[model samples]
Target: MRADRLVSLVLLLRQHGRLSATALARELEVSTRTVLRDIEALSAAGVPVYAERGRHGGFVLLPGFRTELTGLNPDEALALLVAGSRRGAQAFGLGSALASAMLKVVDALPESYRATAAGAAERLLIDPETDLLSRRLAAEEVPDAIAAEVLRAVFAGHKLRIHYAAAADASPEWRTVDPIGLVTVRDRGYLLATRSGADRTYRLSRILAAEELPEPAQRPDRVDLDRAWQERSTRFRSGGDQVTVLLRLDPARREELAGTALAVHAEKRDTDGWLRMEASFQDGRHAVWALWQLGLAAEALDPPWLRTALHDRATALATRYGTPS
Candidate 1:
């Protein structure tokens, strides 16, 4: 591990000519003390590394020092750089590996195109957590050790024993499943697997623990994960406890309603110029949450339960605010 780390340290310095101890530690995912020790190690190993003191000063390597590794063209290097900026790799416990690989990619770029490619990559953003509306899009947290074990099982073609909690408050249940693939959508990781020959997808965040079994998994030699994921998604959307609701929506908010619903069964314009929609949602809770987001712009007409839920929530909020100080 130290050998790998030392090599990574050298690669890091070789990639970015100058970086502060703090900066290096941040990039290395280590502490400053560890970084200092590494610098000494590098120096002892004859790495032409040195330090400069004062503000705007940091560790620097001798000029013209280079590694033999090379050969990414401008477009290839730019593509790698752009891909490296994404956060999905972290979900699979490959964040450090990705960082080291990106550094190597940058270090390998022909100087003629290195800076230009990096600059171009910097101008492009991929799968940013937030949108133009400024709403925070948070990723679910998955423990690295658990994710790593799951990844190991997936790659090794072994059955995985998982302690999974179907809901936040539920007790974890142990299950041995043959992992088919891993899929991430909207930053949430899911493990696609079969338990007792039944398709089951478990959220990575809800996995309390994971153990890779010695027995080889019962899975196909090759899988089309993309197609598998799409089919699973289609089944999920169509098989849930669906609640159909008639909604009177503002024309401007029609798209928002459609976006939140499982399906917009029908849409028509009322004489009053309001958009009427028959929409199906996954469940009662989903319907409530979706309609709540529209405030007064959307009204749940047919579903008495949905209307009652909205009214209750509104009344509770009003009562809370209306109470005497």
Candidate 2:
């Protein structure tokens, strides 16, 4: 019970910032006397603990008091590392920083436990290609410390000043904005926000820097990020932009299309021979790019516009360097 109380105290202090002895005792299912003794034990053991009295305060640690992870067993260490990795990389926490911190934790463990951690990493390897674990991230881009801090600022309702780079230019321009939420679309990470009364998405890769404001931000009352995303997509799709796309495929490509995001929904259209696809997109331009990704199999099927666009593109290429006569 005392050890549980001690662990509870540490976790509570970590999560809740500070807690009065009464609150800690209530949470730990122990008496105030036990909590006081446990706190004394923690402080005596060089936990750098502090206490605050009066109505507005409680037990507090120095702001830099970091919890050590030396005492964990093998399974515990593995689970902790995996969870921390997912949080840092996927959930917008400190990717490299948390990874660095995890290395430190692993180093602090006993030699045998360190081996166990290494074994865990090797055994529990995550293949992002098949599992889609890496889908939420950009291609070959991981959330760095700056992006993680930006996410923190957003979640904490803090405004941000970011140095953003444009696709055309090498120099970064500074802009002050309130971050709304993060979205991962088509394996690319994006930060959605309103800057200068117009909604925009700034790619995480294009953000050069971000600093949080001391003043709070105005968070949306209804945080329907999905709805905002859908609205943006609907506007793009409804603008009479059609792609007369074609797929000249083998069996594998067809099967993959049905199973993957290429299709909105998949149904078996007859048994063996060939599958007819009703592929649609926002416009021919975007559709051209998407079709290009399918390599030889995809081609223009109908709609005069797509054929014209493709023909114009081909002619321009030929004119630029002379056609193969």
Q: Which ten residues in a row have the lowest lDDT in candidate 1?
A: 70-79
**Once all C-alphas are superposed, what RMSD does model 1 give against the true structure?**
3.7
The candidate that wins on TM-score is 1
Candidate 1 error regions (>4 Å): 69-85, 132-134, 268-274, 319-324
Error (Å) of candidate 1 at residue 95 is 2.3
Off by over 4 Å in 2: 1-93, 101-118, 127-145, 165-174, 185-187, 196-199, 221-251, 255-272, 292-296, 308-325
lDDT of 1 by residue, 80-107 (tens): 5435435666666555666666777777
Candidate 2 per-residue lDDT over residues 158-216, each given as its tens digit: 77888888674778999887778877654456777777667777777778788888877
* Best lDDT among the predictions, by candidate number: 1
TM match of model 1 to true structure: 0.87
Write down the TM-score of every candidate: 0.87, 0.52
* C-alpha lDDT (0 to 100) for residue 77 of candidate 1: 40
